[model samples]
Target: MTNRPRIALVTGATQGLGLALVEGLASRLSPADTVYLTGRDAGRVARAVAGLPATSAQVRGELLDVADPDAATRLARLVEERHGGVDIVFGNAVMRIGPDDDPRALMDAYTQVNNFGTTRLMRAFTPLLRDGGRFLVVASSLGTLSHLAPVLHDRFDGLSSLDEVDKQVAAWRDAVLDGSAAASAWPGFINIPSKIAQVAAVRALASQRRDDDLRRGILLAAVCPGMINTPTSALWWDVSTAASPAEAAVPLLDLALDPVDPGHYGQLVRFGRALPWKP
Candidate 1:
């Protein structure tokens, strides 16, 4: 049997879903596979590395603030230099701009960090990702089905298409560019505020990468880890009793590394179920 484990890179690895991903991979991956846990805080990174059990799997801690323009390239280089090529990239980094924060500045930062971060990392290390390598993008249900609830049934179907979604995205992007931060739409585009920006980022990435074939996204997905009772979901999903973040990560792993799944490039899924997203 092959002893090599699948090498992976996970952003925001200091805690939450990222941390869970590392733990899960560490437990299951082959002896030779590596998992690089990246975080903005050097201390947190070190702590996380030290905390994990030392076993056959290789674990490396690195300083990576995905919001930092340079961090994207830096991480890619580190992965390439050390692991040769990362087989799976779990993009688990994202943020919510605060209410007191200046909307314009924060919105720009969101765009630059989330959208641009994904673009830069995926582009810089195209060679590092193999043709069948998986690209798991952690997104929200609000961004996928909620955005398309007005028109589609299977939100997963539209992720691979843009004709319908382009109009909505273009309108919103234009509104933002025009400084009309208040622009509105039926699905309440800006009404929900920063959340919309994250969805836009996912769309922009899918559109841009669909053509070059630079890397076979295989399963470029935006997933809603579900109403896990995490600090972030404490406000909205309280009634549901958020499942352990570690437990929520299982679906993501199922969609990403499932041996039976052919692939789900440019697809949207939540709780292991695919949905429509284009419109």
Candidate 2:
């Protein structure tokens, strides 16, 4: 049997880092292998798939809005039916807004997409992972636990259940909506908390499913791709010195395609190095 994975999927692959991830996977996999380039926008997904080189792995576009509760599940079912299972799944979809936007709106959007979206995708796809498969949450350095207050440490560390994470995330959201988030030590910017929740979800689910993971050789982690010059990043800060999407995608591709290391599972990784969750 060939060593190359037969199926790979990347979400939010319409542009920027997501698009580059699709490119990297397509180039790396054999022509017989398939890479699904998914995004919420049908037009964008179709265009992104059309633009990829036909000489590489077969690239197919699918409309996937992670925020929609049923979207990930539907795709998972379809993938399992067609491919039997998937080799790699990159949860790269996220929602971020400019600092000038209303804080409440940002919190709501971020919670739904970045937080809930991640957990939903994990639940849907984790079971479909083939042996030696990798499921990655495309998080960032901001997702680190150090960004959270010291008081919140134990709530996230070595979580044994996703429900524990959800309760904490919901509490944070309540703090935000009640205008007490800042006073309560939740980050003023909604992105940080949402990312923290995303990472926590990954950690929790990885722990919760350790038995199945070990049995199937599945690997899970939240990865930081570093600062990339994408349209979204350009909105909040000057990305003049930031890496291009292609450059940022390299480390992530390495983690997804390289050999699985159990040590890296359930951790926050940057450039193949796992970062400490605690300060």
Candidate 3:
């Protein structure tokens, strides 16, 4: 192992799974590593950082709103300046803007935060991510092909590169603009489509980066934490079946620190199990 310090950055870490992920990562940090916990709210970020267990790895709070493209750019620059590069990146920030009544409006809002924002972050940080590093996107099972219309599902399954993923997302946006999305069999839940975009992005990135990842020992994948008892999920889930944020974070933390077979790359992991994307 290199003697250089390990750096980790987690977005939307003020509460819920993000916060739990921060804590879990901090608990395992060596003295040479640092975990940066970020959120839009400065006070909330401070509080979350303060609550972390005392550990050898330093925990710092960063103010960031992933929805702003410039913010992602700045954060990536800041990490590069301070640590030279990052070892881990968790794209966990997401927004469930509203119900599906206005499909266009809901689509726009979710697309801005979950899809566009996440894409911006990955673009900004991928350069800063070190070889052999891990990049985990907090995706959801709702993003699976089962929830998509047959045409859209086939398109996503056939994605061969990141550019194609962008094209597919653009096509969906056009469909939404023309009122075709609502008429189609695509699920009405805005979160599902947003997550579908996120997972597709991860898959595309994994494919595009395959050569580098294999040569450098990097791991990239999307993970579903299940229905967690967070403010976001409280909207629909029954309290009894919902898992605590800490409980849901278990798989994420595992993937972050463990050394896995190269086969794990590009797969969608749910509850610690890697599910095949293709039949």
lDDT of each: 0.62, 0.85, 0.81
lDDT of 1 by residue, 1-279 (tens): 123457778887888888988887777676778888888899999999898876566787888887687877877887777766767778876664433455445555665555555555555555576555666767666664455444333322334333333344444445676676344333323324233434544555566565544244344556678767666555434636667878988988777577424334455577666666544
Give the per-residue lDDT digits (tens) of candidate 2, residues 43-117. Answer: 988888888765478888898998898999999999999989898899989876886788776676677777778
Clashes of each: 9, 0, 0
Ranking, TM-score, top scorer first = 2, 3, 1
* Inter-residue clash pairs, candidate 1: 154-275, 154-276, 155-275, 155-276, 155-277, 156-275, 156-276, 228-242, 229-242
Which ranges of candidate 2 are over 4 A from the true structure? Answer: 1-5
Of candidates 3 and 1, the better by TM-score? 3
What's each prediction's TM-score?
A: 0.76, 0.94, 0.91
Q: List the residue pairs that clash in candidate 3.
A: none
Q: How close is each model in CA RMSD to the real structure?
A: 5.0, 1.7, 2.1
- Tens digits of per-residue lDDT for model 3, 1-279: 255888999998988889888888888878778999999889999888887778778888999898786999999999999988999889998876544357676666656678877888888898887877888999988777777767667767757666677677777877887889788866667677667778888888887888888678788888998888766566666666788999998888888888855777887888778776643
| Reference-based TM-score, model 1 | 0.76
